[model samples]
Structures are given as C-alpha cells and as structure tokens.
Target: MVHIQHKVKAFIKLGSFLKEYCEYSKKPIDLVGINGSNLAQFHEKVTLATHKNGWFSQENINFSLLQWSELLTENNLDEWLGNYNLAANNYKTVAIIMAGNIPLVGFHDFLSVILTGNSALIKQSSNDDVLLPFLADYLIQSDPSFKDNILFTEGKLENYDAVIATGSNNTARYFEHYLGKKPNIIRKNRNSIAVLTGNESTDELHALGEDIFQYYGLGCRSVSKIFVPVGYNFDTFFKAIYSYHPIIHRNKYANNYDYNKAVYLMSEFKIFDNEFLILKEDEGYASPIATLFYEFYSDKTALLEKLKQDEEKLQCVVSDWPEMKTVAFGSTQKPSLADYADGLDTVDFLLKT
Candidate 1:
C-alpha cells in the first residue's frame, strides 16, 4: 500500500512545479528539474484545450492553474487531510464522470480518490481531455506508485466499486438509470446566486463582477442570478460591473449576447441592456452568457427560506449578508478543499463504502 505521507509529498512536489509554472508575472518557464520534460511535452495540450473549446479562454485556464497551485501546498494539503484518518487497507477503484464546462472542474474528485489511496478510473470530458492526463503523469513522476493507481477509460466504466458523476440535468437521468445500484454520488445541474439588499458599497458591487464574469459565467459556482429587494435601483449595479464590459468583445460571448438579445427583443420581453450584458427579471436560476437573471423580493425572510428549500438546485449563494452561509462577493470560484461538490464528502463516502 502507498503510504499517506508518500502521497502527500508527491502532491507537494506537484504543487511546487505548478507554482513555478503558473508564475504569469515572469516569462514562461521551461520544463525544469526532474519532471520538467514530461510536463514540457504537454504544453501542446493547453493549446489544444483552448482551440477545441471556444469558451475555454486562456485567462480562465491560467486562473485554474493558479487556484490549484494555491490549493496543493503543504500547508493547505495537510489542513484538508487532517480532517480524516485516511485509512488505506481496502483498495478500490473510484470512477469519475467529470464535467467540461470549466477547466480542471473534475480535479477535486480525482484528488480525493488518490489522497484516500484508491485507484482513480477517470473519464474526462472531451472538452477538457488534455490537461488532466498530463497532470496524472506528473503525479506518477512525483511518486511512481501512482502509475498503477491512475487510469483513464474511454469506454464505459467497469469493475469500479463506486462512482462520482457530474453532468447536466438531462444526462443525470441516464446516469441514475445505469449507475444507481452502485455506491455513487450523482450530481445534476445546480446554479449559484447572490442576494442584494441595495446597501452594498461601490467596491463590494464591483468585486461581485468577478463572481459573475469569471470563466465567462460557465462554472456551477458562477453567479448566474441575483435576488434584489423591492425598489432596488440597478443603475449602481450596472455601473459597478462596467469594468468587465470588455468581455463582450470575445466572439463566442458576443455571438451569445447578440443572439439572445435579438430573441428577447423580438419576444417583446422587458430587459435592461448596456450593450455588453442584459439584466432580465427572471425567476429562473440559470442565465445564459451575457445575461443576468434577477428577481425582486418583498423581504429577505421569504428569500432566505426559498433559498434554503431549494438548496439542492443551488451550488452556492454569493452575498455580503451576515445572516446565512454566504461566500464573499468575489470568492465563489475559489472554494477550499472542504467544499465538496453537491455537499457530499468524497473522502467519507470512499472510506465507508
């Protein structure tokens, strides 16, 4: 069995390499030291990732690298793992069905499986196929024991003890039909939202733009909608997010904005537009790119109650309100190791089942 300390050191080395590689301030570093060439060979994968998926912008990929780099540090890793005993006697293969909406979105599950000393049978999204394979290779280089532990499958999963699957609400039905009998954690579509009491500062509202605009508003953690109190003025909100208006110039985003705007215009629906983003009075949670759905609340009590009741359909709530489980305005994307998807603890599941 691979010792837990060995696995920890292997990931720590990987974190070091990522820290140096993601130093966007300086010139791009060559694959250096022991595992450098292996990583250097995968630079082409990054290019292919952005090329194959128009929504996977270069900035967003870098953002993912930076976030992972910060998370894999010795301090951070130890803190996260300290919560569990990490028993490794019973070895099992944990199959992962990852989503492709954002870069490295499935990595947390991969990490959980590996850190628990279980083999990971990964099935990556075609939209995000390149990066994780190379990352798996890096993990092996850091500790050769993992070479036998990590495997990627193009075909249907077989011989796995448990599953972690993420997909749209549509695909989830198929997964439920196929993998329901197995010990599994199946995730469906969930959107994040924010609450605005209208007492927000200019800077606070401005920082909120990061939550809405990051990753082109693609990730589950992205704030796709907001709940505002009655008599709320959107002029301040619109002005604060104007800094991110440059995102409209991107071709895919521009196409979406143009197409969605034309549809809304022809339908005679009421909307507030600033040529870059549209604000619609929508009760729905998920908003398309270049549009934000908002609903007006008569009071906060009913809104919080509604949010609590529908928590399964929501990923997170971005808010400055001190009353509830709120992430600060700009922090929805930067979840810690403990922030398990669908609020299910992967380590605990893998250990018990």
Candidate 2:
C-alpha cells in the first residue's frame, strides 16, 4: 500500500503544478516538476473541453484550477485529514459518479477516496470528461503507485465496494434503485440562497453578485434566490450586479436568458428586467439562468424557521444573518475542502465503509 504521506506529497506537487499552469500567462513556464509535454497535452485538452461544452469557458476552468491549487497545500490537507482516523485495515474500491454542472465538481470525492487509500472508479459526465482524467494522469506521474488506484470506465460498473453518485432529483431515484443497496452517497437537486436585510453595503451587494453570476449560476452553491425584507427596494441590487453584464454575451447564456424572458412575457407574469438579468418574485429556490428568484419576508425569526424546515433543499445560505449559519458574500464558489456537499462527511463515510 502507498503510505499516506506519499499521497499527501503527490497532491502537494499537483497543487504546485496547477499554480504554475494557472499563472503561466503572467510568468515564464517553469517546468521543473511538471513534464513539458504533459503540460502541452493538458492545454490541448482544455481547448477540447471548451469545444465539447460551451459552458466550460477557459476562464472558468482556470478559476477552478486556481481554486484547487490554493486548496491542495500540505497544511490545508493535513488540517482537513487530521479530523479523522485515516488508517484502514483493507482499502475498498469506491465508485464515483460525477456531475458536470461546473468545472471539477466531483474532484473532492475523487480526492477523498484516494486519500483514504481506497481505489477510485470514476464514471465522469461527458460534459466534464477531459479535465479530471488529465489531472489523474498528473497524479500518477507524481506518484506511480497511483497507477493502480485510479480507474475511469465507460462500461458497466461492477465489483465496487461503495458508490457516490451525483445527479438531479430524477436521476437520483434511478441511482437509488440501482446502487442503494451498496454503501452509497446519492445527492439530488439542491440550491443556494441569499438573505438580504436591506442594509448591505454596495461592496457587499457586488460581492453577492459574484455568488450569483460565477459559473453562470449553474453550480449548486450558486445563489439562485434571495430573501428580501418587505418593501425592499431592488434598484440597489440591480446597480450592484451591473458589473456582470458581460456574462450575457456568452451565446449559451444569452440563449437561455432570451428564451426564459420571452416565456415570462408571453405568459404575462410580472418581472423586473434590466436587459441582462430578470428579477422575479418566486417562492421556489431554483431560478433559471439569467434570472434571480426572490421573496419578501416580514419577520426574520419566521424566515429562519421556514429556512430551517427546508434545509434539505439548500446547499448554502449566503447572508450576514446572526440567527443562522451562513456563508460569507462572494465565497460560495470557493469552498474549503471540508465543506462536504449536502453537509455529509464524505471522508468519514468512506472510512467507515
């Protein structure tokens, strides 16, 4: 078995390589630990990924890389892993069914499985197939022992000890029917929200825009809805998010915006439009792209209670509300390693399995 320190060292090297790659535009390429040929191949794959999925923009891919680069430090990994007992008598094969909503969405699962000395059988979404495999190759190069630990397959999944699947509410049912008997972590549809108290600074609201528009609002952590106080003015919110106007120029996002806006208009539902984003008074959490759903709350205490009752539907709550747990403005997309999806401890689950 590969020792845990070896695994940690390999990931730290991967983090250094990613830092250099993401900042290559600003500095000369220093291929000391990284293979130059592999870097070129990875660059080609980034281009291919963009061609295959319009939503996987180069900027977003780089952002994801940068985030992981910062996160994979030895201190961060040690701190996160120290919380649990990682020693295992016999490592199991953990199957990971990844989602393609945003770049590297399933990487945390892969990392957890590998770090715990378990083999990972990854079934990637076609939308995000190219990047993780390339990264896995890098990991193998950093530590050849990983060669036997990572596997990606398109065929039927068999002989896996545990499963971690991510999908929509519909696919989640299918996953349960098929993989529920195994030790599994099956995730369904969940959305994030922001609570506005009508006293936020201009900077705070602008940062909130980052929480909304990053990844084009496709990520589960992206804030899709907001809770505003009764009689709240929306003009400030619009002006704060105006900096994200360039997002509409992306063809796919623009198409979604135009289509949804037309449907609302034809149906004669009242909406607040700013030529780029629409604000609708919706009670639901999942808002369509280019639109933000909102609701008015009369009392903070009652709103907190309602949110508590619907916690299962929420992945994040962006707010400064002292009465509840909340994520800081603009930091939803940059989650720490310990921020498990659906608030379930993946590493703990894998270790126990």
Q: What RMSD value applies to candidate 1?
A: 1.7
Candidate 2, residues 222-308: lDDT per residue as tens digits? 999999999998999999889999998999999999999999999999999998899999999999999999999998889999999
Q: TM-scores for all candidates?
A: 0.96, 0.97
State which candidate has the highest lDDT.
2
Candidate 1 per-residue C-alpha lDDT over 1-353 given as tens digits, one digit per residue, 9 for 90 to 100: 34878988888887777766666224546656565665456556777888999988778887888898889988999899888877643689989999999999999999999888889999999999988998888888778888988999999899999899999999999999999989999999999999998999998899889999999999999999999988899999999989999999899999999999999999999999999999899989999998999999996788889998999999988887777888998999999999988889988998887
**Pick by TM-score: which candidate is best?**
2
C-alpha local distance difference test of each model: 0.88, 0.92
True-structure RMSD, every candidate: 1.7, 1.7
> Model 2 — which ten-residue stretch has the worst lDDT?
25-34
